[model samples]
Target: MLELDASAHPGGIALWGAVLAVYDTSSMPPEIGIHVHARSTREGDKQVDDTFDTVVVKLSPDEQATITGDTAINFYLSRFLNRDIKLLRCPHCDEAHLDAGYFAVRPHRRHMCQACGRQFNDSEKSISNPVSLLKRVHYDVPPVRAPRNLDVKQTSYPGGMQIWASNPALVWTSARAEEAGLHIHLYDSQGNIVVDDTFDHVEVDGIELNEVHVQYFMAQQALPHLSEKIVSLTCPRCDRPHFDTGDSAFFPHVEHTCEHCNEKFVSKGRRKLVVSNPFEAVRKSLRANWQSHRI
Candidate 1:
């Protein structure tokens, strides 16, 4: 449950953190299981090959899970691709489990697995099946690390969030988050609301979301307090918290449009991120090979 050392970069902590890597190292191909070396058999002195026996061993627990674990499969968020945490496999040894050390200081296709010291293109085979890549989408709340500064005592709790190795990707497509949608408010001592807001659907990088994405949005924006709301913008004037839904949450602030209002701005000098409130505009549907997981 421990986090990376205090010296770990903020970006490193986000990409790696308590991330547990479960490698799909099973070499058994689908339907065509692992094959043993072919042996020669003779028949009637004609050197004719005898029939081969097919073995269908009972699947291991892990293997059985693979068949029904579609909702539990591992996938990376492209929102995190600037660091390219998306693909950490090895070409020399087709290893799926690797670390951020394998990546360059910045975004690049080059990588060398620390396990095998072998080179690979982060772009090459980054995705095994491109066509089947686009699968079900879900929201995730990444593990949160605590701040070490003295100011932290006054601002937040001591313990931080965690995504244990046992199930780093358990929250990949959380049913709880999906069902909860997004709720922003505070109650008084008497259970009266201070400020109330609800979003049945929120949008991130053009991805329509609900309660499903609140945790993820908070993590991306680094909102220290859970009470901190995801948005401050509302509509009618087209003036809302300006965000680039077209822009990435991982590497956001490229587009000058509001995520909720979709209002485009021409200001050369503007804040990195404006106030709360998503741009509420209709955009053409955009689907990508996206998936969700816990860590």
Candidate 2:
């Protein structure tokens, strides 16, 4: 088997490396089954959708492995969410980090210390968010593209709205980014041109227009559209992140409080996301609708 470089992302790699190093896989179970469960968070949903995949690795019965099936399952599950490597410490009873909250980024949403046997609770530990984790692992790595300085401004037109597309525009630059992938509506001030930017090209939405949204629109050519954005903010009280749903009553009003820190934030109103990539916006809309109704 080809070996993966262990030095990369030292913390996370080290843990997996240690597992691989300690596992004597020469003798192990031959038939291994993997069952992945898609958990639904809808109300009144108590069922899990299970998808199974099997791997047949030839091994001896006496072969010793550092990790077992259940442990391996947990290990793989950790990969779904990006974790910080630096926060992990000694898993041994001795020399282990004794904390109830996050020990490292690699193992996130931890409830207990595997090494020291401590129960994690709100008062004791600090939890990381998914966006932060993503930025840490992939965004912060060295020798990568530098962060762009984008000047984004939004304003209203007569009957629609206009959001200035920021630079490093993936839509224009990435060839792989299909036009259909665009989820956005461009309208002229007269509320005349309601262009639905679709995958291959833009289509007119009710409002008559000569063309879809051009790369540039005159200030006079914009429309007035309501904007509802979801923002995640850390609570001032407990410093835990909560999604701000804005203020709208027609949609579900969720009160987001940090389960650990008891920090409180309210996510009110309906979530309205306007995507310049029509495909993404439509897809997200479909998903949202499905989730809302399915639940």
Name the candidate that leads on TM-score: 1
Q: lDDT (CA) for every model shown? A: 0.28, 0.27
Clashes of each: 16, 33
- Write one digit per residue (lDDT tens) for candidate 2, span 187-231: 455546454333222222222121122221111111123123323
Q: What is the lDDT of residue 76 in candidate 2?
A: 28
Query: Candidate 1: where are CA atoms >4 Å away?
Result: 1-89, 99-109, 116-118, 122-237, 259-263, 266-295
List CA RMSD, all candidates.
20.5, 19.6
Q: Which candidate is the best by lDDT?
A: 1
TM-score of each: 0.32, 0.21
Write model 1 residue lDDT over 1-295, tens digit each, in one string. 1111212221111111122211111122221111111112211121211111222111222221111111112122222233223435576887553332212113455666656877777544332211122232234544332211111110121111111112122112222222222432333334443433333443333354332233344333322221222343344347554443322333323234555666665423344333332312211111121111112
